[model samples]
Target chain A: MKKYLMKGNEAIAEAAIQAGCRFYFGYPITPSTEIIEYMARKMQQVGGTFLQAESEIAAIYMVFGASGSGKRVMTASSSTGISLKQEGLSFLAANELPAVIVNIMRTGPGLGGLGATQADYFQATKGGGHGDYRLIVLAPNSVQEMTDLIMDGFDLADIYRNPVMILADGILGQMMEPVIFKEPEKIEIDKSWATTGANGRKRNIITSYNLHNEAGEEKALYLEQKYKGIKEQEQRWEEYHMEDAEYVFVAYGTSARIVKGAVDQLRKEGNKVGLIRPITLWPFPEKAFIPLLNRIKGYMVVEMSAGQMVEDVKLNVNGAAPVAFYSRQGGITPQPEEIIEKFNNSYHKGGEQ
Target chain B: MGETIFSKTKGLTNTPFHYCPGCTHGIIHRILAEVLEELAILQDTIGVAPVGCAGFIEKYINVDFQGGAHGRAPAVATGIKRALPDKVVFTYQGDGDMASIGTAEAIHAAARGEKFTTIFVNNGIYGMTGGQMAPTSLIGQKTSTSPYGRDSSQSGYPLDFPLLISQIPGAAYVASVSVDTPQNVIKAKKAIKKAFEIQMKGIGFTMVSVLSTCPTNWGMSPIQSIKWLQENMKNYYKLGELKTPEMLNQ
Candidate 1:
């Protein structure tokens, strides 16, 4: 294994190549441009293809086409660029294609500046595109995790025959950290369904629901079964100081890293504050809340956005324990003291339900 | 044994076409499938079907096919051809799909010299979505959207797509032909075959536009629709091989 100090965006490119991805199509946007540039430079040396598409819509459809051709393909974009990609994403999902997409998120309802924010939790975890589909969204808190999860993303996409998204933030995208590359586990996926050509056997037709197509209802039912299997199988998270705690802070990605600072300082001051860092944002690791709900006093959801993940926390927690939310907006990270103050202001001390 | 004079090409599946009666799209599809079978690239070909009346092309085509978003068939074809360079790839698009909504995808694919063939069908009206004004609709044509007949100032003149594509330096072959009569259908088939042949030789983008008819949308009988395309559309969009690889060599 070789170690290199690389930006989060650049690490994503290198990791995807190591995972046997040979096709990349993308349009440049801030916090995600390095991913494309890195791919362009490395793809040439790796006997791969890299194309800067005319638009985000073109890039994703190219991904759709390439994936159908039995190749591991990828595309990266920011919040606004990802918005432009929604139509193709819907098509990718409807067609049940496997491709890795990255959204190095920037703050936005629309063009929310070139700064880091976790405002896209709803878009990433819930459905951004118009359809009843779920993207296996992985939120990486550090550059190392970002590199490792991208490799995992490709495998999961191929296994499930669905799209996987790396829901990263601009801060981690631009930050530099040392990452060690490891050999990827070889996974043999049955690509007999791909649209290579009709050389020997019967032809393969890749399509979705159409007006004349009468099998759309059955297709939707089949997809629901696959989603149900995924939810039961993949739920990932990290619990810090969770063995003995009264109040838990639920966060993910950059927001979780910030919340960790508060967890440590609050523990030094004799406060039982813990952290639950969700990795798989779509599956959401609701099981992490179950064991803590009986003994814990309450839960506090910390985020860089207003209050998105908190609702999910409350939904899972039910009425067992109260849930409080704390946040900063517009590319702001609330300090540890501020997080502690919000915690103190919201809930009382002493591990009591 | 009796000698058969005519048979459906093996390049198409047993699935029947869903196009309306008196529409020339059926003729164009048969011509393309015949070309694919004649070239013996049917098994190696991958087609990207455009959104429109051609959206169900996958059901009818025998070779591998991928459905495309509206106006994005060329881009989809680009992806397939680049991924598997040895495989033959093509796109089938309508005037509303290629000339109007998908102009950027079509033009950029040609500009980038993507190695693929495109079958462009020009019916002078939007057929699938009911009779509406298209980019190829004539200056005075009365469509559903253009009820008062198209005013050049309001709806703009018919866009000549092959002429526009031929001007691009990356395009190696472009032809505007028609299937109005039996003789012209043969000529149109020849043009389609040439376009696919150019793609096999690793030439840049190649396209053949077949002037077609839609009697249902044009509010005319099938014979009148053919006459209208020959008299009105033939004058607006000239017929010929607008560009060829030989011309590019020159």
Candidate 2:
């Protein structure tokens, strides 16, 4: 492993290249644009493909075409751009095409500010595109995981033959941190089932087609089974100081970074505070929090949206303990001190415990 | 008179097409397939079929095919070509995909001069969706939605894609052709082949606008639709190669 200081967006782009991504297509949107720019410059040197698409709609379709041909492809966009990509994303999901999409989230009900926001939690974790489909979402809290999960993202995407998302925020995209690029893993290109030319073989068909009612039902059943397998096989989380801790600080991506800082500060004041940061958002590590229910007094969910993820926390905790929400939206990121204050207040009030 | 009825260029395919009767899409598809076969690049080519009538083009064309959203075929083709430059890429698009929702993608693809080809079929009306006035619909042309002839004063004027595309510096070739007659069909094939040749040489964007017949939309018989295209649409979208790298070679 080689240690280098890098921004989260740059790290994700670099790791993608190292992990054998051959195409990057995206539109210019704040917080996510840097990732596109980085790939645009780097992909050429690596003999990969890079394009600044006409719009997010075009960008995602470009990804579909490249991925359809069985090459590793990717795209990066923010909330508004991602919204444009929903049409193509639905197509990608339906076709079971392997692709990587990075959403450096910004605040938005519509065209909100360019600052970090987790308001896209529903859009990213649930089915944002169309049809009954899902994207495997990875939520990284630090520069390390940002670099690490992109490699994992590509692998998971290929394994499932599905679109995988790195759901980050502006803070992660913009903030500079120490990152280590692990040794490049060599991967073999598999074209046995790929839609390369129809040379001397039966033409390989890549489509999301349900010609009849029975076929549609079967396709839906197959997809549900795949999702269930992913839930069992791919749940990842980081439990920090949860043992004998007073409150569980539940967060992911950039919010988790601030929560970590808050937990450190609160510990200096002799308060027992810890964190449970989710690395994979879609296959949420519910089992990690389930064990903590007996020991933890309460759960405080911190994100950049208005209680988008708090619902997940409540469901996981199962009313064993109360869950409170602390949010910062419309592009403003909650500071470490503000989160600490809320935690201290919650602990003192003892309503959640 | 002893010449082969089908062009020597088309790839081998066993199944019949699912297109509507008297549709010109089959002719256009055959022209593209023939061009690919003649260039000896059918084995190295990928085609993106857009939404609307051509959504099932994969079944007809023997080459590798994929589908994109209504107007985003060019964007998807751009991605595929850029990803694998050695592979020839093209998009088969209709007026709806090229002019309406996908206008942003289409113009940008040409402007950027992406090294690929676009086969644009301008049939004056959106045929698959009953009859809607397309961006390319002629002024005073009537459609189901436009009960009265299309009034540019109310609805926007018909967009001239070939003229607009010719203005982009990145485009290496731009042309407008029609499939109204056998002679015109031959000219359209040449235009299509030239576009493919430009891509193989790594030249930037090339587009061919094919003026086609829409019998159902025009409220006419198949032959009358052909006659209408020959008499009316040809004046609006004149045929011929506007620009080509071959000119530079000459």
Candidate 3:
């Protein structure tokens, strides 16, 4: 396998092409602008379409149009730009259209500065749009995972007939690393429900609107069942140093890397600390926590936001294990020493609580 | 079987339209359906349906349709056209949908010269939502929201949307027509057919703005509304083929 040194954003673009995504609709925005720029130059060569929409709002609607046409489509944006896409995202999910969306993190809540921040954890996992829906969120910490997860993201989108999101921060987006491009696996799914010209058949109409209230409620129940199946089947995570560990740090994305560094240092002091890093942030690694809930003394969630993922941690833990949270807000990324110091203070060093 | 000289277009579905008694949306829908049948493009066509009264157009058209958000049909049509260049695509949008809420999507799609057609039904007031003021509502026109007659200072003047669309360099063909009289209906059909034909040629963006009436929303009887539109709407909106590819090149 040839190794290509590339940034996470570039890897996402190339990986999507390899995954057979022929349509990309996006607007230029920070931390992920390279994804669209790369597509603009490379798409026509691959026999695909690339359009820089007038606004993020237009780009996502463009995603709606292409996806409805039975093609694999994608769009990428950062914090606020993703916010502009929420309305279209709701329409896509309600209509059950398959598309991939990537949100590279930036400090936000009205033009927060350009350093990396995991502040959008709640917005990404929870439906940011005005509907009861969930985006299949994939969090990639490194450039290689960015390539792997984006390829898998498109597959998951088609398999489930819903939008899948690649959720990462600026640290992973811009940072370069050597990545091996595996031969792309072709996953074929049925697209008979798609709105392609309805040529020799009954006209297919794609809409999220249900005229009657009962029909809307019935559709909501159907979606709930699909989500239940996803939760049962798609919980993914990485367990590090689980054997004989007394305490664990629960984290993901950039925060997970910082927690790992803290875990390695704390183990040297015989602290018996481990890490549970979630790869899918929505159908969160609840299975990883359930088996250890009775045995582990406490779980501390480290995030770059002010306690967003910690809510999920507490919900999953459900009082079996004491859950604590430490975070840095507004683009401040904490170092491993900070996590270690906070852990020692929170658990009193020996899981005695 | 007796020989038939006239028949309904196969381009329309069996589903009956639910438009109000005096609404001109049915006329526009009929002419649009006729254009598709005449061009032999019904089987290879896709439509983007706008919100408001026309939002339900997906049910009535025989071709495939995608329903857009409040005013995003043009953006949606751009996506469909770009993805399937061999297929003919168009958007049927209302005044409130295309002009008031979806102004950016319309202007930019035309500016980019996206290869598609737009049938903008300019009904002056918000029809589906029960008579609210629209960007196309004329000065001193009374609606439920603008009960005191649309004040120019408060509501701004009526927007001549076709004039704006025709000015865009990417727009290959643009026309503003009325459906009041029988002769004018014939002329409107010609413009509608020409707009779709331009799309088949893979020319730039094309649009035909049809001045429509809403009797229920205008608080008039069906006959009174037709007379009111002829006297009032025709006076304000210029009716003709405003721009053509020929004009653009010259």
> Clashing pairs in model 3?
none
Of 1 and 2, which scores higher on lDDT? 1
Query: Tens digits of per-residue lDDT for model 2 on B1-250?
Result: 6977754445647678776677899899888888888888878888888777777777788788778778888888887787668888888888887878788888898888888899999998988788888888988999987889899889988888877887777788988998878888899999998898888888789999998877877889899888888878888876688777755445
| CAPRI tier for the interface of model 3 | medium
lDDT of 2 by residue, A135-230 (tens): 899998878888888998998898888899999888888989999888766666565666677777777666664358998999999999998999
Across B40-158, the per-residue lDDT of candidate 3 in tens digits comes to 98889999999999888988878998986999999888888888899999999999999989999999999999999999999899988899999999999999889999999898899
- Give candidate 2's error at residue A321 in angstroms: 2.7
> What is each candidate's fraction of native interface contacts (fnat)?
0.70, 0.63, 0.67
- lDDT of model number 2: 0.84
Model 1 misplaced regions, further than 4 Å: A212-214, A349-353
iRMS (Å) per candidate: 0.9, 1.5, 0.9
Writing each residue's lDDT as its tens digit, candidate 1 over B1-250 gives 8999989899778988888788988898888999999999888999999988888988887899998689988888888988999999999999999999999989989999899999999998998889999999999899999999999999778999999999998899999999988999999999999999999999899999999999999999999999998889999997899999998878
Model 2 CA deviation exceeding 4 Å by range: A187-189, A209-211, A261-273, A293-297, A335-353, B1-12, B246-250
Question: Given candidate 3, what's the lDDT at residue A235?
Answer: 88
Worst 10 residues of 3 chain A by lDDT: A344-353
Instruction: Tell me the docking grade of candidate 2.
Output: medium
Decide which is better by TM-score, 1 or 3.
3
Q: How close to the true structure is residue A173 of candidate 2, measured as C-alpha lDDT?
A: 88
